[model samples]
Target: MTTRTMLQRPAFHWLAAAWPYALIGLVTLLVRSPTFGNPILDFDEQLYLLVGDRMLHGHLPYVDLWDRKPVGLFALYAAIRLLGGSGIIQYQLIATACVVIAAWFVRAIVRRHMGEIPAIVAAVAYVLMLNVLHGLGGQTAIFYNALTAFAAWCACKANDANTPGRIAALALAAMLALGLAIQIKYTVIPEGIFFGCWFVWRLFAAGERLRRLLGIAIAMVLVALAPTGLALGAYALAGHLDAFLFANFTSIFLRQPFPTQVRNDQISQVVACCMALLTTAGVGLFQLRTHAHGRVYADFPLLAGWWVSAFAGFGMLGDFYDFYFLPVVLPSVILGAFALRGERRGFTFGCLLLLWPCIFIPANYFSRHQGILQTSRMVSAISPYVSGHCLYIYDGPTILYYLTNACIPTRFAFPDHLTNPIETRALGVDPVEEERRVLASQPGAIVTASRSVVPRVAPATQALVREALVRDYVLIARTPTIDRTYYIWARRDLHPGPAPLVDPRAANPQ
Candidate 1:
């Protein structure tokens, strides 16, 4: 039979043909087994985990913890913690399941638009993409991104005439999922904006005028805002309204320009942006030429548009990290896979042949950088040290949540006078007064990025820390990895001491 004849086979027959691909994708996902790896405790992960841990202990994210993230994320983490016992294994399992389910959604969406083979290819590509794999680690952002993709898939499925009810259900689901995504990281805002636009387009295509669209939009807004509004109400009731509004919301939005070290090279930035745009455009052109009228192909533009929106939004923020693009890039992988499938057999094979080396060559080089592997190891090793002591970590939240059963604070506080002057001033507090308060409190320990500890503090505050170390405090240990330096300091007498004289040289230690 001709390829076209085979492609036109009955749905059940097509399912039978595609079963092998599904099985392969499933096995690949299972073997990758999200839980086998240790949890990496980075700043965001640590904070999220801490919030989850606190929730488990009756503290809320924006309430007891001073975080700006919406409450949906914490609630989800709380649910996971309840189910999985708050271990790395449980969290990994949850993350893995989320990815697998997302893959299934991708398959369903693809099957609806493209034929079985293209659907299978899309699913497999999604499962194997570097960003997808990168997200499998125990971070709240991964779950949030997966949720975003799942919501988009639901919307795609619902847009079909045969599935209006399904679409409504999916819209509701998307609304709720977005609530949770926002809670995990506010960055999902741009993603929501992108999806919201698509949702409106879908409504418009359904022959609904502005009035109907407005009604549906209002309903969606209400459903999405319910969880967030409820969380805010709870925060107000707890008498933390100011803290929630100021610290979590306003403070973050008003953050200063990117520091010198945090900024990327302009040339590299332009190059990365070009590569992303070209790849997206290439996929779009391929789709239009090969399957112009295909529903599956049609969805590509919407998905790609959302991705482009997210990338542009994130890029302009100046804190662009490769992983920030994971949510948007994930759908593109499937589109790219389908694009490849539509190519001539020989060309497709040639592209496949070059793919591995293209990825691995650079990855291998990055692995050799100083402290890279060591930093990874330190992050992975955080699970064992979560007992008894209140774990203070600057960069390792994912690790902290998996390992400890203690209440983790939201923001990592520095010594009072040493706090970022700009941040302190922005919050309308005198840095010196805040410093005195923090010193008086005499926290058990302070954990921070080694470099930030210097630049963020005034010379006098730096001197205070050095003097305290020399007299009233002891250096418990110093954990230096390629990407991080963790200094654990303890009181020399395990109690407060006389306020020591500040040495100016302490701040700019040569």
Candidate 2:
């Protein structure tokens, strides 16, 4: 073949290899189903959903729920509620869409760095990765992962010499995405820091003049600050400056260590977590050595740093859970895919054999097969009956929020000395006093974990609750399962109120 034809053949071959990535993307979207059946799992997820539902009904997020997340997430949730209707299925679908998009971005980044086969493998591994699969229902997990992948893609594009303008645009886009991700979960801050430094380093290495680099840096900063600035402005205009500052900025910065009750101690769980960290670190180091002199892929280092930082950070918090590391694991798989590149086919098969067992064993053994699902369904069934009200729940916010479309407030308890002074003071108040205050002020149902309630409450408080239930309220439903207790209490005197006017398009600007 002529030289021109030889060159064209390689380009054609590369284009042909893209089919697998497209196939993986299609399969990922097809497999998208509501895995957990109900939107509630962890307390935080449920809280956010309730807040979102309230926002849909013309209530502001931080102002009403006293939540810490950025306005962007609330806005997204509000939009989803508008389009999909007031159902957990709609929320699940939106979260699923975010995962699918994130998967596609992962494939794109891998394809750019390693080529088609490895990229396809990485994308599949990303969707199938145990954390991603299990935490698909989580709002922060889904949004943050998607945002991280998009940021990585932008960083990669930014590093390309042939497309400087395109790179600048992509870099700015990445910074904005990073800002949103940071709002969703504070863990994304390191991603922005690492990539910002990398941008400077690349500019210096390329002999770009200082003045031009400074200008570029300024532009990037403005782009990054745009979303955050907008969110702050929204809160300020709504007369919720205190809530915005205390919840989003101060409270998040002062996150307390996890409580002892939620801490995990299983030997296998510990081993699996350790292995995952080791594998990720090993792959990252290998990539650094191999690509040290090559063009920056951007995804590898950002993800590797996210993994190390989140693990170290969450490990310091005593009540760590598996889902806490969900955002970091997506990039780890992509890095692992790069590490497995060029290996013999047989070796790849062996790795899969070892990996499958590690991934499935914990999921099958520890996760109560249908326990969470059942709890979620039961809660959802009773939510409509108590829609325009508050729920006092003792445990698991996920199920409560998923079921009732109302915010369930838990009495905040201080387990760490590091807690904010205000929060500590609030927790210091007697539980009886607090429960009484809530009962008198917030007209709603009170659901308690039967076993926990029977033992934990003092005699006086227990008697008061029983009296209220018998005289003032009626037992609407009771769902008892092997590992959970659900009781729905509706007020007898307060008849079913008018359906709250929920405006789906009230708050979402974009």
Candidate 3:
């Protein structure tokens, strides 16, 4: 075949189109592999995985595990655990894949509006921003943000096409993708709404009749609701509908607001992140205006709308955490990529702007290496103590529960439910009663963390669990070399007798 004909072949075209960005993505993955390979276990990661373990054993979430996280999050973990066993390697691999895919879409979306260099820069910016903004280490945001990015790209692709059937198919797929994303984290709901509205507007702008537009909107809404509907249906069939509803939806409003000082810290962190990206993007946007073209102007609304939606989603709960800033990273980078439009000087400047994150994230990751090692040692040391026995972590790291493979005596995983006043009120659980009941069984190991290490426990519930631990158990081991505080307690009666020593008043009373 002639060179032109060979180059025009579909497979060749696909490879020609894909390989460069794919190469960039692979390089991105390699740069990030150190952090991904050596997983730094987060409390959230532990609880989600623990819930997955329960699900693996045929236990449901709200009914058995008692966490407010959406069903889809645990389901992802459960699937990963089933396929790869309870190791961080599979989770990290999956997370890295999600990030790469998202970065690829960021490039595809930007390339449609700008040159290849700017597009590649946008993709790299996304990878850097996500890591530096604390979006790493197996967080749910990694997966959902990728889904949203793909959805955004599909929306752009669908908008540019003239065929109704093609548009309809893309719209349906996008909505379903977003529905799945929403189930992973309700925080993504605003972005979903933004996309839905944008999709409707695109159809309407295509000059469809009002009636047809209404019909299309209804169809899209139905598609978007499908994942959640199926989830609700399954819970209903299993007779866990109330539990599912309360945990997934109702309990969020009941969560107590953070203390004013803590809330201020969270706010400052969120604001700083937003300002860092936005200020940089704003400078780029000014340059973009100076070199304005119809194409760039046309794309402005889409990028801006995405930014607003992401910002809204991040702050949806009127509270902030480090990971919450993740969704905004892509839009910020894409907007900043516009500044690379002019000449070599502009391109060089944009490269420098994006390079700043490369410096700090590696340093930060290395600094935390010590903490990761300490955590590993602690988990290893404590694992043997709870083998084949029930364990209770009284205001301690939830990761220990997962590491030990022990039976949990209570639904509350992190003691936040029993100790955080807001959490207790939100769940409407009696903390003292819950503690008394958990202690009644006299678990083989009751691990109590030092007060300094155990953050955010309510005073009353802390006292209640502590008192029960003191009365019922004897200290067996204390982690000496680990940097953090950890104490292991064995039931006092179990050492001397086969049957658990029962005190009728203590066991039966309120």
Candidate 4:
């Protein structure tokens, strides 16, 4: 065979098409691999995994376990557990894949109006922005961002489709993807509405009759609503519909907002980190005017609409947690790509580098992974105390529950539900009553922060837990950490001996 035959092979074609994305995935892996085997990166992912682990054991989210997060989020985690068993790396790997896939779609959108270089820059921005904004581990945004990005990419395809049937098919696919994304988290509702309207507007612009346009609009609406409708219907049939409804829908509105200080800090950090990227995106938009970029100008709304709708999602609930900003990262970066259209290769690469500045805000998000080895030391020192019954982390990391693999005594498994002062009114159950009930169950182990560490804790709940610990539990070990210390407590009634502390480097990582 001629030398050209080798390059023309089917496998070679696949490799040619895939290498760019595969390389992106590899870089993402290296950047994120440090946190892999190190669980407890954040409270949210650990709790999701714990619930997902329980789900595999035939426990349902709203019925058996309680958290205000949507059922689909747990189901995502449950799928990870099925594939990788109870190990933490499965979810982290899965979340990383989702982030990379989302970046691929981000590139796809940029490619429509820009070249491969800007598109690649956009994809890279999406991945790095996640780390800057705290998307490192298995946060919900990691999963849903991929879904929503796919949906938006589908909408972009519909924009370019010529025939009516093709447009309808692409639009329906976009709606279906958004519908599923909504189940993952309701925050996608605004984005879905915008996409749905984009399709309807496309048909209207094509001069379709009122009847046909109306039918398409209604069809898109129903398809967008279908996943959530099915979730609600399943609970209705299970006779636990009310429970699901309260936890998923009604409770979020009732919850108390975070304190003003917490709110201000998050906003300031997001702005500080986002300034460079936003400036780059703005410069790109500004340059468009002088450059006469006709093709980009024509397609600008699709990109701008997505960024507005997706970023607006973080504010929907009046909560501004770092991870909630995940959905917007892709669109922002893609818009920032407008800056790359300039001729200078050096300047384009420097623009991409601007994304890293945000990493400083999370402040040791990456560095803290080093502490994972030291922190795992507490597992051996504490797991023995919770050998049979359960472990309750009243004032510590929720990851401890997974680390110990102990039973949880309450449906409110998330520590924030009981510990945060503002959550007292939001959860359907009284926070104090639930905490007392957990204490009464007498978990085999209870973990609390050392005196110096102070996060947002409810004074009433703290007092109750502290008094109970003093009366009933003994400090078996004081586990030192990179930042602060935590106490592992065992029941005094057991007359527990000194729990030997495992060396920081001792526990084998999975």
Candidate 5:
């Protein structure tokens, strides 16, 4: 059979086609197992867990607790929380499942160009490459990557459809998938734009009239935006459209820009983390370019458009942190498999060996050993002290709230909003003023990380928290980590003011 025939080949009976997914699922867990249950796995995941927990207990996203991420992201976590108690293991497992599903999509998409064995290798690499960029946990990209890949697959189906009705069905499905992905992370917008144009162009190529195409374009756009529109509608019904708008949209612009040098350094770090990927994937693309008109050239533009759009977003949104690279991982790896088109299984493993060293660098930042396990010890220490009051995290992990079973005294509970210099002005509220309020509220306990370790510390806010610590709170427990120590401070008024200190003579009427 020809390559295109293989692409369009009917799936085997369910039993025959089920093994790849089953194998990929097991590989995902085995690779991701180390980081499971690590609450402090990623700071962003920590916030998601906290939001999910708080959301269950009558709190809302923007109004009740502040974060600029879309509500869908929080809603996903909230759903994860329902799997049981706190959602640490649950979210990780769900994220792993997402990775596995996404890998399957990757294999399905690239198989036409790169045959079955190499295509499967490409899929496994996507899962393994995630660790190279800290995608081992519940990063927003974890969920949306799968959704975006599914959307791309739908678009591919549209490309393959011979019947008009089938084409329309696949196009709408792709648009709706992209729309849901937007609710999860706005970064996917660039890729969505590509898919939108792809649909319009495909319909135009199919000889649809301009007016009908216009209507189709409008419908696709609306479908993609519907989830976000629904989220806003919910907020509107509660009469807090402004709060939702500001938190979800405006607050991001409020953040201070990083210094040029710092951003350059971040870009450098991302590049370093991706070194092996670049070497191997880069060589593959070069090989394809040299051999463009060969049999491995099916639907090349579709993948290229998706890859370039995501890559541009990654480049332009520098310093948004490295997880921005996660979405780029999908297309790059599949495209990279272009090198293995007619090669043996040995070449697949050879390509993977190049990515091995790159994995360990970013992998160090997260691990079951490096993350929440150490500081979780402080939970037992701070739990008794913070029994009935909020536990303020001045410059520490946000997961402590979930761990210690304490409330956050303020909405700016995500520490970066207050403690990170780059976020000094980004949150709608004043970070320092918010910090003052948390300290002033006399929280049951406070957590702070070593300045050396948490480099994003805002000097002014750090000073303020330090002064508050000396004046009103006392150091209770210090937890050591790979980098430095994280300190827990308890409110000094642990005693009940010495029972109001009444004079004996006055009580006796002397």
Candidate 6:
């Protein structure tokens, strides 16, 4: 009945060890479940799912559906769609698993250097940080960051073991994971390079001989390239090698540079992020400098390198989207745990600081009540013409492609390629040619939104598609929403309700 007696019980010890994981899972579900089944937004999620559907039908990425992301990304979405068949919950489940695994790795890495308390706090912090900003969504970072953390853990193990067999195995594991991570998002390649440096430093620090080190290095190189090489081989076999090369490797450099104002906004967000994540950076710097002579400090360099390189690479474009920051958070949380070592009450204080965003930001940033049902009316209006025929959406939600279950006539899903010069140039796709091809196919129904919409297709792209519609189609119905007017057009031969689809803007005279 005494506290000491109770603590000594097997059941009590088991409960103590398992509660944190259970709690993390519970919290992840609570925070993410609401929008788990909601209709896809017009963001990356919808775009990815649309591409995934095409792949499910045996069409390859960039060949049938074009996006600049790595093929592994499309494969991931395909897996999600295959499992859940377009339901949002499958993606949510995958997202939750990622956070959980990332948190576990954060705790594992920290617990190696410190007490159980700091490790738990760091793990919990990792989960909390993920939920804040746009991290709650099913971003690529959400999945790959877990593997990144696992790679970090493997690196740490390699250093700790310091034996040839263990070191080689762990090194290979780390490099292979890093390769897969690279395939998920090429931006993380910088982190892999950083890891290479860390791997070399560890070998040297362990006084690895020239012969042994060279052999290990050779093995590591082969292992690292294996995933990418296999992917390339698969594409080559499928006759999409050129498409894969252009989208995954070449397109990144060709992306249009951000304009002055947009760059400034992104810079401001980066600054705010640096301020928000100052704890990780500060701790990492302090540990690397102050404990330079300590054995444990050897790991600090790797953490610092990962943080700096990942931040630089991902932020290279100055894109400040909330989810883009997720990859960099892993090293930050690990460094934070190291920073908290030996401090009294550090766990409580650290948790409070880390949980700040989770407590306040999401409620304000995300809508409390929004669902797929909001778009039901729009789907209803356009369903008839598009249900069984080809559909083209010049300025509408990509989700419409899913709801209507129609064939998309072109590789370009949204008008970003047509409107944004950088997007057009980066993808190496000619929007005009694509428009001509798509229009030549003559989709049975074409949907466009008025310019007033928050995210209408690029003006020029809209104009090109709109011009073709005017010349060949007739408007059957127009529905007005708060943000924009939705125009549904049918081919003139179809005689869709005797209305002129010819530039409703010109005819209505608003």
Q: What is the C-alpha RMSD of each candidate to the true structure, in Å?
A: 6.6, 8.3, 5.2, 4.3, 7.3, 3.9
* Cα error of candidate 5 at position 17, Å: 2.8
Residue runs of model 6 more than 4 Å from their true location after superposition? 1-6, 114-117, 287-295, 316-322, 338-352, 358-369, 449-459, 468-510
If the candidates were sorted by their TM-score against the true structure, best first, what order would they fall in?
Answer: 4, 5, 3, 6, 2, 1
Taking all chains together, the TM-score of candidate 6 against the true structure is 0.86
- Global lDDT of each candidate: 0.54, 0.57, 0.73, 0.76, 0.77, 0.71
**lDDT agreement of model 4 with the native:** 0.76
Task: Supply the TM-score for candidate 1.
Answer: 0.73
Off by over 4 Å in 4: 1-16, 287-295, 345-349, 352-355, 358-372, 451-455, 497-510
* Candidate 1 Cα deviation (angstroms), residue 22: 5.7
Better of 2 and 4 by lDDT: 4
- TM-scores of all predicted structures: 0.73, 0.75, 0.87, 0.91, 0.90, 0.86
The parts of candidate 2 lying over 4 Å away from their true place are 1-18, 34-43, 112-115, 130-134, 162-167, 253-255, 259-281, 287-291, 296-319, 341-350, 353-391, 396-433, 441-444, 450-476, 481-483, 490-510
Q: Which digits, one per residue and each the tens of the lDDT, describe model 4 over residues 1-510?
A: 887999999999999888888878887787787777666576678888888888888888887788888788888888888886545888888888988899889888878877887787778777777777768788778888898888888777877766767778878888998888888889988898888888877777667778987888889889988988988898899898999989898888887887788888888877777776776766655554445454555456776788789878978989777678778776777777777765784266446545465445454466555557655776786677677778887756677777677888888887777877777777888988988899999887777765423346677777777777767776767765645567777777664454344333211100
lDDT of 6 at 306: 75
lDDT of 6 by residue, 36-140 (tens): 765543256777777776788887788888887778877887888878655566777887898888888888887777677777777777777766646666778
True lDDT of residue 360, candidate 5:
62
Say which candidate scores most in lDDT: 5
Candidate 5 per-residue lDDT, tens place, 113-193, comes to 567776777788888778867687889888999999998888777777656556667778988988889888888999999
Better of 5 and 6 by lDDT: 5
- For candidate 3, lDDT tens digit of each residue in 468-492? 6657766555543233455666676
- C-alpha positional error of residue 204 in candidate 6 after TM-score superposition, expressed in Å: 3.0
Model 4 alpha-carbon miss at residue 491, Å: 0.6
Q: Name the lDDT value of residue 505 in candidate 1.
A: 27
Q: Given candidate 2, what's the lDDT at residue 127?
A: 63
